[model samples]
Target: MFELIGIPPQALFGQLLLGLINGSFYALLSLGLAVIFGMLNVINFAHGALYMLGAFVAWFLLQYLGLGYWWALVLSPVAVGAVGIVIEKTMLQRLYKLDHLYGLLFTFGLALILEGIFKHFYGVSGQSYTTPDLFKGGTNLGFMFLPYYRGWVVVLSIAVCAATWYAIEKTRLGSYLRAATENPRLVQSFGINVPVMITLTYGFGVALAGLAGVMAAPIYSVNPLMGSNLIIVVFAVVVIGGMGSIFGAVVSGYLLGLLEGLTKVFMPEAANIVVFVIMVVVLLLRPAGLFGRER
Candidate 1:
């Protein structure tokens, strides 16, 4: 019976829910980017490729090992994180002291190679991961029908994002990470193996991206290009949130998603570019980003 600007509540709320779901993915992926860039100072352009790898890894577990979603949820990230560790130790570390451009270029090239390999085999038709048995139903919300899996996604993603924020902003290990990034030699003097710590931090960040990928498998068609398609927007999110600002990344992701959802209902023509438009505005006003500190 109630409508805002002549638009039905169901349509508006549905778009909001959709925005929240997308924001969850954006938060997860951008959180990883924030961590890696914040702690390691590496501009990881391969993040999307790594995300794509996570989805494929989940698919592989399901198709080849009969592992199912739950197992893939755990294993895919671990696998991707391990790959991240290798990347850090073998290659990424070497460029730490160099220009940020180098790291970006190296990772970007790596992403291309990875995407090419997968595209060659998969042919980009895409694969689908079925919703788990426990999450295949829908709930009537009086106004809108909400799918169980979509609700699960929103809750779990918020939990994960909250947990990550707490870990980095409140805990002792988080302090150490912050310290090491600020002055590795000082932290090393405290007997912390800074290199190892940095390595693990990068791994953990990559794992977050992988976790996002696995969660997305059932909702979006699993394809080699999926990560690439979504990643540019994620990068925009990180920039708007403030590069390397953990809290900024989380908040910006959800905020942008909601804004995007609103745009879809009010002005469908601009929905696609709304996020970027916001990014441009944010940059013009505060180049450092909404939550980023000026160095």
Candidate 2:
């Protein structure tokens, strides 16, 4: 019924909603990076590959095992997370005593290898995933139409992010996790099995990436490079929010998403680089990030 700055309500709200959906993915992916970096002190450059792996896992389950989208939703993360656990135990554990750059380099190389292998077999083309019948339609919300699957993605992403934040910020296990990262010797003295905790933390972190991949599979084509396409932007979001800041990651993800959407409406050309531009400003203004504490 009304227009804002000459843009119709449908166009404005539609972009905002699209932005929110993108933010949901950003929040999930960045949350995982924040957790891994904050807890394990590993840069985890392979996170994008892990995300791609998750989507591929889902597709594999469907193509090979006759599993459905629901099955992929539940199993893909677990399968990819297990892969993370193995990577941590077999490879990443050795880099713990080294510099952060080493971890980054190691993971970056691993990402290349994984992507190469998949590309050799699957090629660079994107694979299609059908949306579940449960969420195949859209709801007309007077001004704009909202896709059911998208709404589900936003709701589920928010719920998962909230649950993760609560578990890490408000629970006993989270305290132990924080403690182990801070003082491994003391935590180990208490018989907490610090190594195991670290391993599991890494697994859980990548699992978040995996879950995001599964969620994205239907929306975006399940391509090997999908994660690579988004990882940089997600990293920018984490930096803007504050590296290792859980609350910051979640907040920045959605906020940046909205901003990007708005930019698209007003300045389409700058939409792609808007997130990085904000990141540069944030870095210059506050090196520690919006939610990051000064170390």
Candidate 3:
């Protein structure tokens, strides 16, 4: 078999597939961050905790309510999203007039509180979530074996990302959202409810995180720390992609994921820091990010 850089094709393909899967999660989470920051102007440090909540909610549904994977996929996001609505109305809405640091600090404290509560009740140990029977096997793809669930994750994530991009970039509602972000007072003068829109936008961004949590539950050990571990990487992605640039967030997410995967194969010792390294380089070269428009 032909080899690239002395690595076997199987190993290379396997790592690439793994990278793509990781990238999907990054894209989803960062997309949410971008959306929230764009319209609500909040950093949403509690996003990771909300993601953890989504996974726990799914587990609870199955454990106590006799629901299954499919049900969790549909309900978890909605439940978590409702929680987001409450948080926005009662807590986040009050911080809009202050410096952005206030929003960041508030959400950071919220994240800590949420994680602490979960740790108190569930402990630090991870819980297992079974893959649905529908995605129970793997298919041979010449060089590597692709698990059905992983493939589903990749496909579904791409579909969701694409759909979100279209909705925000190409639709009339999206135009209104963009306009509101640019000038809430002007939009409000037109009789549009800007405050409610801000609230809903925050909820929607968090719902994306909840959706990703459901997708991740079957693959990762569902734990309080899972989202926290991934969230930092996602924040790096958002920074590299540009704070409020939707397209930048999605593209840079997958790009960095693949870069990280390649680094693992080439320089295993640097795998963890590769994404940040690239982020530093990108910032030096184009501070506005690859897809971000300069203000």
Candidate 4:
């Protein structure tokens, strides 16, 4: 019953939770995009379509093979990553040396194709995935009742984000990726297959998108159009975070999510515009993004 700026703590915290959950999706999806753009120089507009594909992949497994969430966790990313590999080889590889805009356009077209196909079959009515048995309960936290699944989402998302950050920021392979992006010729001279490196990097990024799709399967209604709608907001997050900085994407994604949550409690009308407002402010303050250097 405690009042927080004229709103109850329950309302505030609930909004906060919603914001964090949405932010998790933003972080995961944007991180993948940031990686591809920064390192591979590919503007992957098809990412959201690929994310939708991941969710569908999970649904397919459940329906036809009787696979559970646990199995989908391991399998969906692999499946999607394989598809990414095909895309890179068939289409994206040809555009590496051309204008970056071409990459964006090609991928955009690909997104439309994918969305069109799914829309044709599924018709966008939305499908649901039930939470697993282990994650279906709620916990009384003394102040409020917290659903186990929501908590699991928050905790697992943080862990995945952290692990991804560590892998790219702290490891040797990450060093090569950074180096290769800055100077592919130099990295190739060092005997690393730079082309393969680019392909794998793109795949890994797509795999991250797949992981997000699987994670989101149970929480949000599965629908063909889900990724398309969320992708725009995520793009705004990328712009705010700086497309070149992975950590920036992750941190800003979560921060904005929390900010959106706070807005929902005190000024519901402001929730949708708050992120863009912040993005505009950030751009005015630092045109290169919060963590990026001006080019």
Candidate 5:
């Protein structure tokens, strides 16, 4: 059967695992984008740059501060999130009353500035980050070899995604956020500081990107351009999932990742463009996205 398909089970399953890992990142990043767009109405092009910052911060902690992967896991996201809070309060807040184009342009410029600074300082070369000691090995799963750290990444990502979904969909704080986004004046009248909520929501969204960066550092080379390469695909994921639907973003991310993996197994040459192709199809069929409701 394997020969009939012209591929071995090991290779198929291996690609699937890799796809899941990539999907994990997509889900996390797109979730952040969805939250920010849904609440703040900003495109946030700097998200990828902030992601890079997270990985670099992790590298800096290990290199200069004599810290380890564990510390990086905890601190990197918080540090980048702090930067996000500052940007939101000082710059992004000013553009909120303006056209959405202003927000996109501002973040695009911010991304360029960030990427330029990092490239100049760190050089274009990639940095290495070792997997944590606890997750340094692999397991034989009868059919395929599973790396402990990779497995941890998938599990942790799923948990975080689920937690975020729950918070936004079911919690009191989420209710306030949703309400404020829909009607800031009314929500403000009810004594819920809408501005503060927006600020925190942006921070939280960026922090999710940072967390993904930290998770990715050990798996891929920590290069300045890493996020730039990945962000486009994530944006495509967002479009396919629908810009306004959180559930759509998460589900489409994983599904597309799996599809991409299958594409690699079946047609290696088409793998790179498969996501975009699917995005075009999805847009044509359902402009509001699979889970998005028409406004």
Candidate 6:
């Protein structure tokens, strides 16, 4: 393979795995963004910060309380969601009446503050998370030796993405959510509590980010800046996938990951920018995104 493309198949698959792992983060993060935007119409620029916060919260839990990954998996989301609730009640709630940009700007500023504070204390150097003992090793297949953690991330991300899609698309709660978001007056007249639903929806969105962060903590360094670049890629992914479609976001995310992987094998230099290029092409082809309904 390297004879022809100047890259070995092993290296290619490794990058592909990297892309897929990155895509998992993108899918999870974007799903949260989509969920928040789908119902609340607020672009949560604080999502990235929230993700980083989750990792720190997990780290603190482990370091201070001797909690393990299982506990972090359970506790981190709750902590992050609490902060999200505070943010929503104190700041984001006020901007709902204004232009959508206000929410975005406010959240963006909040992200900067949160990230800056964490950096001030933790600095740019990231801390390491020990991989769980159960997921510590790799599996040898004929083609490649698959790292257990990477494989777990991909599988778990897909499961989560699928579950979210089903909940939003199939369940009664999802029906109310969609109805409320589409027309709060009508939904309220129908006796659903739109305000509470909106709050939970936001919490759910932030919780998803928290979960992603915890999953990421072991794989990547626990750093304040982790969310910054990842969030940008995820935003591009959401834009390309059609913000309205949960399933679309998941599928596009994984697909782009594979594509990025292939690019590394065939064209090394273009690998980094391939996702953005795809986003551009996607936007050109469908301004509303692949699954988005035209307004």
lDDT of 3 by residue, 1-295 (tens): 4365788878888888889988999999999999999888899999999999999999999999989999999899999899999999998999999999999999999999999999989988888999999999999998788999999999999999999999999998898899999999999999999889888899999999999999999999889998899889999999899889999999988988888888898899998898888889988999987777777
**Each prediction's RMSD to truth:** 1.4, 1.4, 1.4, 1.6, 1.2, 1.7
Q: Between candidates 1 and 6, name the one with more favorable TM-score.
A: 1
The weakest ten consecutive residues by lDDT in model 1 span: 1-10
In order, the Cα lDDT scores of the candidates are 0.93, 0.93, 0.91, 0.87, 0.92, 0.87
Report the Cα lDDT for residue 112, model 2.
Answer: 90
Off by over 4 Å in 3: 1-4
Candidate 2 off by > 4 Å:
1-5
lDDT of 4 by residue, 73-191 (tens): 88999999999999999889999889999999999999899989999998888778888899998888755678788888778778988988898889999899999999999999999
- Distance from true position, residue 200, model 3, in Å? 0.6
Q: Once superposed on the true structure, which residue ranges of model 4 sit more than 4 Å away at CA?
A: 1-5
Candidate 1 similarity to native, TM-score: 0.97
Off by over 4 Å in 1: 1-5
lDDT of 5: 0.92
lDDT of 6 by residue, 1-295 (tens): 3668577667767777777887898889989999998988999889999999999888998989999889999899998988888788777888999999999999899999999999999998998899989899998865578889889999989899999999999999999998888889998998888888888888889989999999999988999998886888888888888976777788888888888778876787997789899899988999888778777
Predicted candidate 5 versus true structure: per-residue lDDT over 153-214, tens digit per residue: 98998999999999999999999999998999999999989999999999999999999999
lDDT tens digits, residue span 152-248, model 1 = 8889889999998899899999999999999999999989999999999999999998999899999998899998999999999999999999999
Off by over 4 Å in 6: 1-15
Candidate 1 global CA lDDT score = 0.93
What TM-score would candidate 3 get against the native? 0.97
> On a 0 to 100 scale, what is the lDDT of residue 30 in model 4?
91
